[model samples]
Target: MSARARRWPLVLLLGGTLLLSGCGLFGGDEEEDPPAELLKFKPSLQLRKAWSARVGDGSEHLRLGLSPATDGTLVYAAAHDGRVAAFEAGSGKRRWAAKTRLPLSGGPATDGELVVAGSSNGEVIALRAADGKRRWVGRVSSEVLAAPAIGGGLVLVRGVDGKLTALRQDDGSEAWFVQQSVPRLSVRGTGAPVIAGNVVLAGFDNGKVAAYEMSDGTLLWETLLTPPRGRTEVDRLVDINATIRVVGEDVYVVGYHGSVALLALESGQVLWARELSSYNEFALDFLNIYVSTETSEVVALSRRNGREAWRIATLLNRDVSGPAAWKNSVVVGDFEGYLHWFNAANGELQARMRAGSKRIALAPLVVGELLVAQSEDGKLYAFSERGKR
Candidate 1:
């Protein structure tokens, strides 16, 4: 089989096993249970649409890492077909749009002046944020599946080959590079690096998280979030593909088929860990950390002790995005393009909205008070609290 043909099963498996595992051809004698119906609920809070726009053809068959990046005033987004656009955060008016004519698989990272994205051909294109002018293009070792991070005058990108490369922000020149051991069989996606103070934190397919010095690419510390277990390779597959979260002095991360762990930022010490499996980003407030599990359940746990607060499993098998906290509510998007809101204090359904007819592949971007979501069909919608300005 060609490489393209070989990738299809991996993509389907990462999306969810229900697509193939439940079939009678797989040798199960008993019939699988049907998915639960979505329950009807009364509206507890109101949400109003602020503005809407489009980028280009969004992720169709490929799981694109296209997400919106903001600089307080303008929101930047990208499509898989190499179209990157910027819009005013308040009005949703298009500021500028640019096309690289390449198949983009990752990015839309910006640090106010420069916006950088990665193409499937291993090229990183940088554009000016003011008018969408091309600035520079740099090459990497392989495909980049995560958004690049900018800090300490460097743009940090993590590739699917388990390599992290840092490029200078002004000229796209190579600053430093680091490589980690790549597992032979792992998930299809990568976690974008998070920059805090003078360090950059990233996760690997080997179920490890490492911190690097931002200025020189020095390895500060590495910790195994989940040690591989079981007998078979599939049974021992544990990848830390979820983005790491930094809150004050603590760092939080999750691994597939493994655990959610809280580590001390200063020494990479495990303070607490809870058995969980997730490949999505997480949100945090003062009291709890909100997460969307691999089985499509939304859960909240105490940040202080890693104790479970509440979990809502009504959206199982829907391929839900990670939770994003807004006001007193937590929001999550599903494959059917529906955005569900739950009260943060308790897991009560408060409101729901449909962004488009296609699936919502990424979490909603919270811009101040506005909630911005991008659907698979290339539609972008900005919403706000009903009564507020």
Candidate 2:
């Protein structure tokens, strides 16, 4: 593959292809962009492991959207073996676990009342957040490759068929549906819809971002982050498979072979756009935004105008997870299950910790005080930093 062809999952965006063959997007041969060798560095910060637990047989080599999420107190996570569990945010105590018995892929979204997760077979399983009892099961159009969004009396799920289906919170029933046209080639997973005040924002595989009314699924506005190019479909891919972030009144989204642009919340208008290609979600704070590029370069940009603050290519081709910002530090995991923390002010490597040897495919979730990560083999870990090294 040429430099222009170095994009994400080149598989045909079929309904079920992503479930089994997503490893193609995450791996390559020795000749094509070999994994970058890691450089040894002294630890400057003490990132002690808070806790670790087995999340059950996890996604394995598949590229699933299962990640950890938290509601202020309890942390929730799901796995491919139909296991969804809740843990105490601080102590890592096993609160509850629900076995839905579906090939679960996306989510375990929580709002303290209900914990919801999606399946690779288009099933949305909702459970009681208190006891992990199964509440309701709803079906979507196709495979759910992303986490469902929970808010506003509705649970929003984006299926691989390009449909965004909204289910009633109390009972799992379809309330409204809106869908976009899929491209010939797309990445494996889809980004979860984000719920703000009255609007829910999401990006699609069609290289566009749209906003819809959370009340009745009305289309608010749509903006294309970038237009696809090149004679080959590989070069023209602009899938926004990574979840978009909404900060106050601004929305930030990045895609494969597309521009990472800041958009106005009310209207899907692009405020500032920059040419940076990525398929992973980002870590955002009051000061700066951090993203892991397609080749695994961690770059920090200004939240105001998308200006480059600093970047480090030491982890290139390591298949780094998306960055997580906590306590003025940026955290990311690599294919080798090593968690690296960097100084937010500059791109200096401060500390590193190995969770295991499995690949960490998703971004670490910063829940209150602890930073949580999940490995491909279904292991969950929590880390917290201290002043002493």
| Alpha carbon deviation, residue 29, candidate 1 (Å) | 9.5
The model with the greatest TM-score is 2
Model 2: per-residue Cα lDDT over 103-197, one tens digit each: 98898788889989999889999999998999999999888878899998999999877889999999999999999989867776789999999
Winning model by lDDT: 2
Measured by TM-score, how close is model 1 to the native structure? Answer: 0.92
The parts of candidate 1 lying over 4 Å away from their true place are: 1-35
RMSD to the true structure for each prediction, in A, is: 4.3, 2.9
TM-score to true structure, per model? 0.92, 0.94
Give the alpha-carbon lDDT of every model: 0.82, 0.85
Q: What is the clash tally of candidate 2? A: 0
